[model samples]
Target: MSQMQQITAQGRQIEQDSFAIIDHEIERDHGGHSFSPEQWAVVRRAIHTSGDFEFAKLFHFSDGAVERGIEAIRNGAKIISDVNMIVTGLAPRRMQPFGVEAHCLISDPEVIAEATEQGSTRAKVAMQYAARLGWLDGGIIAIGNAPTALYEAMSLCQQGKINPALIIGLPVGFVKADESKRDLMATQLPYIACDGRKGGSPLVVAALHALMVEAAK
Candidate 1:
């Protein structure tokens, strides 16, 4: 039941060591911004997952984002990710207890064809398709590779086409990445984001895992 024994059994000494390093780094580099306990936990895990102290500063969340995300997960909300990487990174066991599955439609032939026909990115098309299928309604959206996907999701919410329970918008790119997240913040939706275009699939999965762990508790 101890941390060290569990680490040895799981062969996750690297992860344990990384968390130790993250704790040391945070103590060494923490600034004036004091986060709430929940926010701190998410930020701490993100740092532990990526070994990036900068993430502690870059991560952003709307008011009650974590609470709402945990609620949705506890209610067995499906997770719709923008890319396959996010889906692949998600541990099935982590979500199985919630009776939900992680899904990605970017590679689906219909999604690809629609993206090409509409002159849009596959990520954007995938979001639109999910919306059309009523999948985003009350679902958790995890977007980590394409800004267009986040933008499309926000637009759908604006148009009253869908209402996702929570959105993890961390797409990493210069073109419209920061702007897309900024726009997402303007909406009424709860969201977790990494500001200024500094996020990726790993961070997205890390955020979800943190939320799921928090929900389980």
Candidate 2:
């Protein structure tokens, strides 16, 4: 066998072993939680990605959030992200078969220009642009690195401007990250979020990929 093929096999084996370990540890340590199987898939993926079992405690899922998120993925929902890291992290092989499209407009020229003119964040302006283009309706908005983006998404949802199928609000920082996630939980929107500031792009990617994986089944 080719060396490259051997390395690929080894990588897959490592991933499988890691997941096995995560499952065993989570079962041993946090078996009392009430998450359904699908929700547990997402939480397990988060733990696998971050190596932080604390994610089992930090994750918050709204009523039917996992079902709605999986439904949206199966329906080929567009995914709007606050930053490019999430866009890059989402595996195309996992998304393309389901016709899912992930976008990050934070670096768009128009978004940058508007944000500069308004003295606001590029993430916030990008969300406004997405709303104007009607992409938020029935889409999955994943905000993993910017509190401003999460705040704007919540504002738009509250104003009835956009009705996303699911919002993954997991921005990380010392600023308004915790407050934004709390505000999202207070809303009636369909959502999955981290309860505190301990979230990032990888968590969002893990959550979405988990949903995609479940949808395929």
Candidate 3:
């Protein structure tokens, strides 16, 4: 076979093997859980991405969150991320079928100026920017790198400024990361979050891909 075919084959094999390991370990270690098959798919992807079985315990999904996420993706809802990492991590091939696109305003000139002027983090300012642009409505807000962004997104949702279909609040940090996720859970909005600070862009990407896969099915 050609070199390109060899590489593709290797990649596919690696993913399959990794998932097999994840499934075996989860079944052995975590015998039972409240997550449904669809919810377990998202948690399993997160474990595959992080190599941490702890994700199965840490992850929390509001009622019907997985269903809401899949419905939104099927309807071509926009995905708004806190940082560029999530935008970069998301697979275009997976999203393209639904005409879905991921966006991040953290590096925008306007967000920079406003954040600097208001003495706020770029992540927080980016959420405000998204609310102003009306992109938060019927969209998925994926925050995985900055806790401040998660906090701001929660505030916007509570204040009736934005109505995102689902919020993936898994920002990783030493400051307010756990607190922010707890705050997200307190609200009535549909959300998927890691209960502590053990989250990152990879988890957000994995969660979105899980939803996309479900939507496709």
Report lDDT (CA) for all predictions.
Answer: 0.86, 0.93, 0.92
List the candidates' TM-scores in order: 0.90, 0.95, 0.94
lDDT of 2 by residue, 16-70 (tens): 8988898888778777456899998998889989999988888999999999998
lDDT of 2: 0.93
lDDT of model 1 at position 195? 74
lDDT computed for candidate 1? 0.86
Best candidate (score: lDDT) = 2
| Cα lDDT tens digits for candidate 1, 1-217 | 9997887667666766776777776777675346777777788887877777888778888999989889999999989999999999988878989987889999999999989998889999999989888889999999998988898889898899998889999988889989988888777788998778788899888989888888899
**Residue pairs in steric clash, candidate 1?**
none
Q: Tens-digit lDDT track for model 3 on 11-45? A: 98998899888878777777855689999899989
RMSD of 3: 1.5
Kindly give the stretch of ten consecutive residues in candidate 2 with the minimal lDDT sum. Answer: 26-35
Using TM-score as the yardstick, the better of models 1 and 3 is 3
List the candidate 1 regions with Cα displacement exceeding 4 Å: 1-17
Query: How does candidate 3 fare on TM-score?
Result: 0.94
